[model samples]
Target: MTPHISRKTRVTGAALAAAGLLAAGITVGTAGASTTQTSAKSAMPIKLSASHRAELLRDASTTKAQTAKELGLGSQEQLVVKDVIKDADGTTHTRYERTFGGLPVLGGDLVVHTAKGGAIKSTTKASKHSIKVASTTAKIAPTAAAKSAQGTATKTLSAKGADAQTPKKVVWAASGKPVLAYDTIVKGVQKDGTPSRMHVITDANTGKKLFQYDEIHTGKGESQYSGSVELGTKKDGGKFTLTDDGRGGHKTTNLENSENGEGKPFSDDDDAWGTGKPDDPQTAAVDAAYGAGVTWDYYKTVHGREGIKGDGKGASSRVHYGDSYVNAFWDDSCFCMTYGDGEGNKKPLTALDVAAHEMSHGVTAATANLEYSGESGGLNEATSDIFGTSAEFFAKSEKDPGDYLIGEKIDINGDGSPLRYMDKPSKDGQSQDNWDSNTGGLDPHYSSGVANHFFYLLSEGSGPKEIGGVKYDSPTADGSKVEGIGRDKAEKIWFKALTEYMTSTTDYKGAREATVKAATDLYKAGSPEVKGVEAAWAGVAVK
Candidate 1:
C-alpha cells in the first residue's frame, strides 16, 4: 500500500482510455479482447533508442486499431490519441494512451510520428515494457475493499471526513501486473487547514493499495479584482441555472461547506450578480462565473480558441469548497473548476486569474495531454500560469492588473508576498531560475520556474523593468541580456506552440522548437518573436 501525489487532474489512465480517440476529429473503433497476445510475440517493439522510434510507427494505418495491430498488441488492448500535430515538413505527431483488457496503463503513453502521406515514421514511448497482466477478477469482497480504501484515505487525509465517493472499478496498469482496482475519492480537510480530496486506488483481488493522488491543488490569489464584466448565461425553463449555453453551457454552483452533498446551482431573478462578500454564497459564484466568461472571451478574442476543449463547448466552475480550505483545482474527471473558500471563508479562490489558471489545465489536457510529471509536468503547470497571466491582462481589470507575479492577491503564504516571480523565480527560495539536470525532481510548481522565466524574458526582456504597474528585475543564466518582443507577441507565439506544435512528451527543448516554429509561422523566420523566443530559452539555459 503506497501513495502517490499527482497534479489534481481527472486524467487517470482509465480516463484517457474512456475518452477514446477524439484528437483527430475522427470517430474510430477501439481494439477489444479478441486482440490479446503476449508482448514476446507482439510486433510493437517494447524499447526504442530514439525519441521517436521509426520501426514501431510504420503501421499500415494510424488508426487506434491499426496502431495496436501493428504493435501486435493483445485484442484487449486499446489506444486513445489525445493530440495530433502535423508539421510543415509533412510530419505528423500523435500523442496517445494505451489500455489493456479495458484497463488504463500508466506508463503506456506514446507519440507516433508519420510522414506527409500518413506513412508511419517514428514512435516515442513512455515505457519500454509491454502492458500484460495475468488476471482481472477480484478475490476480495467489495465491502472489504471499501473499508480498505476508506482506511487508507482517512489515514492520508488525517482529518474528520464523511461518506467516501463510491469506489469505481478501474484496471491499475501503471505498476506491477495489471489487476482489478477501485478508485475511491475521499473528501475532507486536514488538521492543518488544508482541503483534501484524496483519490485512493485499491486492488480488488489482493486488496493491495495500488495508488493514491490528492486532488487539493493548492493556490490562492487576489487583491482588488473584479470590475464590471459581461457574462454569457443560459435560461433553463423559466428559471436561470447559471448555465452559459452560448459558450458550451458553462455553469457555476455552490458547495456551501464544500465538504458534502451535491452542489446547488446558483439561481438569480436578474442577470446582475455578486456582492463581493463571502457571506453571500453567490459572491464566490459570481467571481467564478465572471472569471470563466473572461477566460472564454480571452481565448476567443486572442487565439480564436472556442473553449478549453476547442469544441466551442463550455466547462463549469464549483465555488464555496471545503470550509476554510485554501486551494483551487481543475479536474478532467469532472471537466470543471473547483475552488476553496479560503482561510476564514474570506478568500474565495475564484479570482479571475485563478479561474483562468485552473481552466487552462483543461485546455492543456485537451491539447498536448502533457504527462503531469518531471519536465513535461513542469510545462503543464507553466502553461496554466502563462494563460492565467494572459487572461488577467486581457481582462484589463482595474482591480487586478496583470503582472508576472502569480497568486499575488490570495495571501496563500499567510503573508502579502506573491506565490512566484516570473522574472526572478528564486525570490521564493525554492524554484530554480535555471534548468539543471536535477530540475525534474522538483515539484511541478517549482520546476515551472524555467519556463516561467523564459516567458518573462521573452515578453519583457532582462534586467530592471516595469509592466502594467509592477516592478521586475529579470536575470539570465548565461550572463547574456536578451531583448523583448512584447507580451502580445509572446502570448500569441506560446499559444500557437501549445495548440499546434507541442505534444504530450515535449520537454523544454521541444518547447523551444515549438515556439520557434510558431513564431516562424506567425511572423516569419527573422521576426522579433522568433528571435525573442530563441534568446529567451538561452536565457534560461535551455539551449
Candidate 2:
C-alpha cells in the first residue's frame, strides 16, 4: 500500500490560503510576514562538496580502528564505515555497520555525530547492548538450518519449490538480546511474479527459527500512466534507444511478456513513444522510461542525490514482465525495476508513482537498508510511499496529477478505488490508521498506515481538504488538531532522517526520534517545523 505529491503548492507570502494558514496555526494577516521568517529558518542544509566529502571518508576510514574501543564495544567487535554526511556548520555524521568476532552483526548499524573539532557530539544506535556472544561456533549444521529456512519460506510465504542457500553465521541482535545465529536465504517465485529472497535467521545453539523476512518488495499498478510524456533516449545510427544519458544513462528494456531473465533493450526508429493506450507495447515502455527519468530528476533536483545509489550510476527498468502478472518490484540483486502487464496484460504496471515507489526501494537499500520485517518493514514501505508521492508531486504530471492516493491511475483493485490512501490509511480496510501493539504483526503494506497518516498530517494537517481535484479527510489517533509545516519542509525532514539517522532496525519510535532530530538539524530546536513534526507523530500515536 505505497503512495506518492508537487512543490508548486508551496505556501508563499499572502498566498497562504485561509485553510493553509489555519492549518499552520497562523492568522492570514501574519502569514505574509511569517513567510520570510520561515524561509530563513527552513533554508536547505548545505550539501557536502565532493572534496570535503572525500576528506571526511578518508578521516572516517582512518578512525575506524579506534571506533570500537572509543564506543566501548567488545574487543571482538569492529566498525565498518557505510556513509558520511557533513552539515553546513562543520558537523559530521558518520554511519557504520558492525561485525562481532568476524561475523556480520544484524541490526548493528549506528550513526555518530561529531563537532567541528572532531569531538563526539551524539550517537544513535540500532542496538544499545554491548556486542558479546558465548562463542563463534555454531551447533546447528548449515544443511539443517537451510532445510528449516526453506520450509518456512514454502509454508509461510507460499513460495513453491523454494531453494535454500548455504547458511552463513552472523550475530542476531535485532530484538531482545544478542545471540549467534545462522542466516539462510531461500529463493523461489511468489504467488505473484515477484522473486522471493526470504532470509531466515536460526539460533546457532538451539537450532530454532528466530526470524524471517523476504528481501523482495512488491506493489500493485498500468501502461502509459502518464499521457504522452517526453522520454530521454539515445541516438544510435538512424535509431533511438531508451537510454537516458542525462540521468546516469538509465535505460528501459522490454521483457517480451516473459518472467525470466533481462529482455531486449527498447529502441525506436523515431524518438516518439507511446500511443497513450495499452494496445501499443511502446506505450508501456514510454511510461516506464518517463517515470524513471522523472523519479531520477526529483531526487537529484530536490535532494541533491545524483542517482538511486547517489553514485551517478543508472539502474535499468524492464517492462512487460510476465503475462497478467499484476505487480511491480525492485530487485537490488538485479539493480533494476520490473513491471508487469496487469490483469489481462492490458494494464501495464508502468505508472509514474509505481516507478517512483519501486525505485525508492533502491534509495532505501543504499541508505538505511531497513529490514523488510515487522515494524522496520512498515517504515521501509512507508519510506518508499512517502518519496513516491513526493516524486509524483515533483513531476506535476498534467495527465496524472499528484495526490495522496496511490495507484489511482493504475486501477489496481479492478474497481475505480485506489490501492491505498495516505489521508486515512484504513480506507484500504487492511491498513492501520494508528499504531497499536499488533501493528508489527500485520503485513508491511498494512502496518505502513501509521507513518502514512503521520506524513499526511505533517504535510496537510487533519480534517477535510481538496487538492488536485481529489478530496481527503485525514483524522488523528487522539482526535487532536495538528498544524502542518508544508510538504516541502516535511520532505526535507524525511530525507534527512532516512539518510542520516535511520538504521536497519529503526521502528516507529525510532522514526519519531530520527525525524525530530532531522527537523531540529534543518531548523533550530523548538522551531515551528520541529513542533509540527512532533505533533504529527503524536497524531499518529507514534509518540
Candidate 3:
C-alpha cells in the first residue's frame, strides 16, 4: 500500500488539511474454507434476505425531500443524490453529496440506509462537524494569494530541488469554513522523469498557507489476474485501441517510454496483445488494461459501486511510464491511474492487487475524502490495502489467488519478499501491530499496520491461520484470543463504516467505534460480527 511518495506535504510539515474534524453485514460468497471463530451473540439485525431487502425498499420514501429530512440533512444541507443502489433484497442505500450556502462541502458526503417503508434506519457522515463559515469573501487580493502560493510552492520545491507552476483559485469549504483559496498546482518531472504534482492550498482571505498535499499517490500492478481478459476495444480505421467500453470507457494508453504525454493507445488489427515480456511493450498494456477491468469488476460486482467515483465513470490508466520507473500512482487531479515499468521494464508494476490498491485511492477521494495524513492518513492507506485484498479475493483468479501479502509479485524491493504482511505486520520490521498514542507519528504505510492487523484479526482470527495456501500466525497486543467474522462479513463491515460512519478526521479510536457501529447496524448490537470487531480491535491493542 506504499505509494513510494509521501501522502500530504503540509506547509513544510504544518499539517495541511481542514482545520476541522468530527465524528454490515456478514453475507457473502466463499471459495475455500478457513478456520472460523465462534458466532457472536448480538441483538437481531437484518438477515439480508431478498424479501427483507425488497421490503426495506418497498417502503422507502421516494420523495427526495422526505428522505433528506429523514436523514437529518434537510436542515441546512442540500442532498444531491450521487447513487441509489437497491440490493437483491430490495434494501436501498442512497449516496449523497452535500452543499451548504450554495457551495459544495468537500468532506460532507454521506450515505443513508432506509428500511422498508422509506423509514431511515441509519446515516453515515464523512464529517460530523457542521459546515459553517463567518465569511466567504476574500480580504486578500488575488495577487497576494498567488504570491503566497508561489512562495510556499517555491519553498516546498526547493526543499526537493524542483521548480513551480501556476496556481488557480477555488472556493474551499472543506474545513467547514467557506474560504476563498488558491489551489496552486505545480508540475515538473524529476530527473528520472517521475511526474510531480504538488497541490498547495493558500487562503484567499489572509494569504496564509492553509494546507498542501501531493496529488501523486505512489504505490506499486498485469494480465496479472487472468491469463486473458475480455476487453472492450474500439476499432479506429482498423486499429483496435485499448479502450474498455463496458467500464465507463476506461482507456489504457502506452507511454512509449515517455514520462507525461498520453501515449498512443495499444493497437492491433487482430486484437492480440503483447508476449508478456519486456521486449514487447504491449505486454505491460495487457496487464494494465486487464488489471483495470478486474478491479472495476470487483467494485461493481461485490460492492455495487458504479466506478471509482461511483459516478458510472471510468478513469484512464497509463502504462509503461518512464524508464525503469518502479512505482504506480493515482492522481485525482487527472482522475487517472498511472503505472511504470519496474527495474528494467521486465517487472511492470501492474499487478492485480496493485491495480486495486491504486484505484481504491480514487474511491477514497470520492467517498470519505479521508485526509492523507496522521492517523486518518494511515486509515486511508489501510483502506487501500483492505480493498486491494478484497478485490484480489473477489476476482478469485487462478493466476493470483487471493492472499494476505501485498506486492508479493512486484518485487518492488528487488528481493523476493512482499511489500507488507497482514498476518504479522511487524514481520517487515516497520509496521505496527497494535495502536498507541504515537502511532500517528509513524509513516502512513507503517502506521496502517494497526488497522491492517485489526482487519486480519476480525476476518481470520488470531494465532495460527491459513487462507488460499498462505500461512499466518497472528497475535494480539493483549494476548487475547480473537474469533473472526469471516472476510466477506468483515469487508462489508469495513466498507459500511468507511462510507457511512467515519469522518475525515477519524482516527484509530474513531475507526473502532465506526466499525462497531457498522456491525451493530448490519448484524445486530450483540451479534457475533460486533463481538469479533471488538475483539479484533483489542487484539491490535486499539482499545
Q: Which candidate is the best by TM-score?
A: 2
Q: Candidate 2: TM-score?
A: 0.90
Candidate 3 lDDT over 415-491, as tens digits, reads 77878898889988899989989998788899999999998888888898666667889999998998777787888
- Stretches of candidate 2 above 4 Å error? 1-55, 224-226
Instruction: Tell me each candidate's TM-score.
Output: 0.72, 0.90, 0.79
Model 2: per-residue lDDT, tens digit, 173-292?
Answer: 988799999999998998776788889999998989999988788887664333344567777666677888777788788989887787898766656665666777777777787778
Worst 10 residues of 3 by lDDT: 14-23
Tell how far residue 417 is off in model 1, in angstroms: 2.5
Q: Any idea what lDDT model 1 has?
A: 0.69
Please give the distance, in angstroms, between residue 491's alpha carbon in candidate 1 and its true position after superposition.
Answer: 3.2
- Higher lDDT: candidate 2 or 3? 2
Would you list the C-alpha lDDT of every candidate in the order shown? Answer: 0.69, 0.80, 0.69
Q: Candidate 3: global Cα-lDDT?
A: 0.69
Judge candidate 3 at residue 356 and give its lDDT. Answer: 84
